[model samples]
Target chain A: MSDVKKFMYVNRKAPYGTIYALESLEVVLISAAFDQDVSLAFVDDGVYQIMKGTKTDGIGMKNFSPVYNALGDYDITKLYVEQESLDERGLTLDDLMDIKYEDEDDDWAEKPSIKVVSRKEMADVMDQQDVLMSF
Target chain B: MKLSVLVNEGPYQHQASDSALLFTKAALEKGHEIFRVFFYHDGVNNGTRFTVPPQDDRNLQESWTALQAEHELDLVVCIAAAQRRGILDENEAERQGKDGNNIAPGFRISGLGQLVEAGIESDRLVVFGD
Candidate 1:
């Protein structure tokens, strides 16, 4: 059916500086409610959004980094983090927040949602999406 | 082919609206059907009827209105974003007790579901933003 479209959300900006990150999350949440096949890619500065120790208290903003932890509740578990972006920023996978979900089909085994991919590999994922929304 | 276009930025301040317009016009010229054009975030500002740009420059709102007139394009402004940005329709203005409504012709305020529906109904969903 044309209604079950594969949606890919591309996030290329850092969070907090602008509203793109928050607005994008809102769209993703809305897309999830539609039960569409959705995937998210964090490229460039977008990777910074998921990094650990993201304190927004000084900015008088809520710490939104923890929201990534709740994405699995919406069945949104495909989060691709570009490896090149992390390397350029001198960040390692450990620097990111651990986002995992329990797979009920697999005896409730915990599974990590974030996938580290190369720039080229991320391009392949983008190609497979029927609808791509950027933020 | 049925296409869905999403504009994520305001007009003039960014190249998004201009590019979206060009792309929509080209797609229409090529005989492609537009399922809908969703305006989200700051993009909702593009649906205001009260913009008064200089006479020398082309008015983006008028351009969009003319295109919608010619093509019957479905222009949907996200209600949440429109309300936040003060781009209210008559119903919304009355509900909010505002002085007036400023929603441009050919644009209707709706929910975020319209954006998702466009992706499902359209063959391609193109996003224009900064």
Candidate 2:
């Protein structure tokens, strides 16, 4: 419980093509177990990680996109997708998977977990974090 | 101030490990305490004693080993990443059914928790990677 810092994981690479996305997710999952204030920011090609309809059957790889859905269950739900990256890829928030979590503070109200933010807003979040782990 | 260094790339293939080493050296010269250098992803390759670079070139692994010897640095290679990339320590090699270990001097294979600990304990966690 000591030395709990605001940890931010930056993901700027796409999934499946390389191992960065999966490895980043693994670390994020591990960080979640620590009860740290963890946030995951997806920019550049990384925004594709949360995109809906991620079909990996053609490539014969595990569809790790589902892991994003489980982030809420693990209490690691602050998922940020940069607006610039998503717009550059011709994607809107509707193209992303429906991720949500139940808030006990609000009598178990379910709220959307992913946040679509501007690059500036993402930068501000980065500045606020005590640690930044990029992948 | 205490500093933690994170290297996410391997040896000569990328500048990450090299940059991390140089940064660590400079930080030490400035009288800063290095809490730990946690190697993750492909960076675990730097811990292998099997790396034999050309005599003419700077041996990256040797540089790190020398740093560890000179300053008693905490160089930790993530066990999960190491196992995934075949950089096994003596005990890990035996447990994983390998013939022998190739972990370099001064570098120890540990779990990813060390990284989290370093991130928390150190004033700054500088990551050098691709």
Please give, for residues A14-130, the per-residue lDDT of candidate 1 as tens digits.
999998898888888888889899889999999988988887778998777877898888889999999999999999999999999778889989899999999999999999988
Off by over 4 Å in 1: A1-3
Regions of candidate 2 where Cα sits further than 4 Å from its true position: A1-3
Poorest stretch of ten by lDDT in candidate 1 chain A: A1-10
Quality of model 1 by C-alpha lDDT:
0.91
Instruction: Give the per-residue lDDT of model 1 (tens digit) for B2-100.
Output: 998999999999999999999999999998999899999999999999999999988999999999999999999999888888999999999999999
Model 2, span A13-111: residue lDDT tens: 988888899988988888877889999999999998888988888888899988998898888879988999999999999999999988878998998
Count of steric clashes across candidates, in order: 0, 0
Reference-based lDDT, each prediction: 0.91, 0.91
